[model samples]
Target: MKSKHLILIFLLIVSAKSRAQTNHQTIEVAQVDSKKNNCVEIPSTFSHEILSESKSLNALKSKKIRRVELIYTRYKENADFDQNQLNEDRMSRLNQLLPKLQIDKPEIVWIEQIGATTSTDAKNYFHGFRIYTDVAPVARTYQRTHLNDLANPAVDFLIDNTIGGTFSHPSGTQIHIPANAVIYDNGKPVFGKYTISYSEYRNAAEILFSGLPMEFKDKTGSYLFNSAGMYEIRGTKDGQTLALQKDLSIDFNCTKNEAGVNFYEMNDQTGEWNLLKSDLFSANNPNETPSAKPEIMSANSEQRIKRGVAPDNYETEGSSKVYQQLNLVYGLISSKFGVYNCDQIFRIANKTIISPKYLDVSSKKPIKNQNMICLIDKDVNASFSFGVKQITCNSQGENIFLLFTEDGEIYALKSEKDKRVNLNQKEPEFLMENITNKVKTSDDLKSYLNI
Candidate 1:
């Protein structure tokens, strides 16, 4: 009887310990904060860290995240049908770069042949692919690891840069990679070549983009603690301006109350780092097709469309006139009106890429008012709005425009430099544009404007 009692007591103790440990590990489960749709939102800190980190960027944890999207673009094919060969080389190089990452072979996603007309430059067949990975965040893992809690001083320093309470906004950063420009790791406001085209990498090693220089070290793009409490690399390519970045390759894990923070060793001593267990998933603008709308753009501003130019480098006279024109429109909205409230875009789509990105503007806000917009860079990448300001990103950019009226109507057309001049430019008109009209509401906003 005594022996039996001792065995039972021991089993109970072991069971309780096992349960405690399980609870201690971090897991991301999706819980609908609002019922409009199902999405996995990163904690505010996570989004800020991820954006700031994406700036330093570029890769993630393996076990915690089981997938990633590999994206690339080519301007011209080499002489000997080498376009395919080159793509293969790049894909192989990526796999080799992330030996630990579980990614499959690359498959062609888009093949474009352009001529010198409205679109500049001609090219042979272009090939690219979206490689799925279960092991990757080459550097971003560090931030995700400490999401629930701050671990190291370096991370702590970075976390401060990420969004915080009192003030929270997306990282509207656009880093452009001009032709042959010296890729600086950390000379300007943000560190990155921003120049991530095939013309930029030039080598297999560059595919990894992790150890370029300490300047481009993204704290959030490091390592994270997986469900098993094991450390691994993982980070999603938040957005890219590849030729025309169609949309973001979204990597997400649903949550009950919305949390995807994977913990790590240097985690808080005692905090709610691992309270939930959920499955993480990945998404992207798989087959993004640019909008083919023929609309008149009264874009006459120069400051708005500058890519690769940081907030500090705004006055480059040689920047794109077209880019500046659009920027002028955006500038008008910002200066006159309030910061876009995530559901407002003052101007219509000037240019749309082939890649598709389902603009996610806080599905949780019941009465939220923010509009998002996207554009492509150099015909290879796209930029999504981080907030109101449109910054170039990984092949995709999203900006939220604010509306000053109820029923989500009335967008302000303010001008940059507080000048109330309207450049006499007509808002971008999309005609025959292959734009995707999402039927989110019973009545379409376009219908109200008779678009």
Candidate 2:
């Protein structure tokens, strides 16, 4: 009886061990399947609409995330097409269309766009793009490594037959192939560029606009962080002054409150970056149909200006805060007025600098009644009762004021002291008053500042 009992105990122990191992294996298999289904597979030959929908829908189906970041690497096409034919096509369009409707060859070519979206509750999504050359080999490696994070482009390119390799050389040939790129949101092109490198490896690059040597680098992949600003490119092409104007903002991530680059351009001479009338989705104006003579702009002029001009630093007591506030207000006003046709705010600020009404604090004193103006006063309480008051003076004695009105509107005012503003001043009058707008609540004030 003792022998039989020992045998039964041993068998029961063996059975328990077997059951434990089986459960462990089942868990391991389940984990692998979970990882596999973590990503949403994109279909080939999808339109921009379908691609966007896939991102949003796939994002929703994932685990509950507070934020989803979608990063897109712009499309990169091969240079197989005849350069001569492409140039001829541009010329053909230029010749057929009137000068006003003329377009130019997009210096930037974007393709193989890959991005990822992370979402919270699948309803709010944040998208970001990796600004890299999506060459096939690099993309393939990225795909295997970043399956759950990186987006897959609908189409991709294969490496040329010119280079073959089991491994790349330590010091390979330094080839500089022109590349084009742009940032987009919801199928709309926001920022266009000619800043990409097409080679075996991806180049982390920055953008150099036509008239600016300032290299704006992309942060957190190829997307510029806090990039909502205005950029201008103006030059004389064929003696008919040409200008490229860009108004850029970020597509705010709903969960994180972070923004990525969203760029747009205006029709030449429209003086407004109107999304409805302008091309919003194309980095190279893909939607712009009419072709114009190839625009030839040299970077030399921009370089010269950047080197020659040094910005004046206004050192004044408590004026720094005033300047900061003024900048915030300017941005807000510009955005609110973005709908209406207007000149660049900097130009307006420059014009305001020469206004005679602006106090030259270098030689003047902050007076309550001297700089104030009243457009209307119901009680005939004019003078300083409903206008600007100089609250502080900079080291150069520039007046910084707190502007207020009877209708509960208030603004911060600063005297423009840039050399360019002074040189361009034909007359000194009170144009700086444009900075003063009556707004209610600090939130309204902050909104104007775009904070």
What does candidate 1 score on TM? 0.20
RMSD of each: 25.7, 28.1
The C-alpha TM-scores of every prediction are 0.20, 0.16
Question: Which candidate achieves the best TM-score against the true structure?
Answer: 1
Instruction: State the local distance difference test value for candidate 1.
Output: 0.22
Overall local distance difference test of candidate 2: 0.23
CA lDDT scores, all candidates in order: 0.22, 0.23
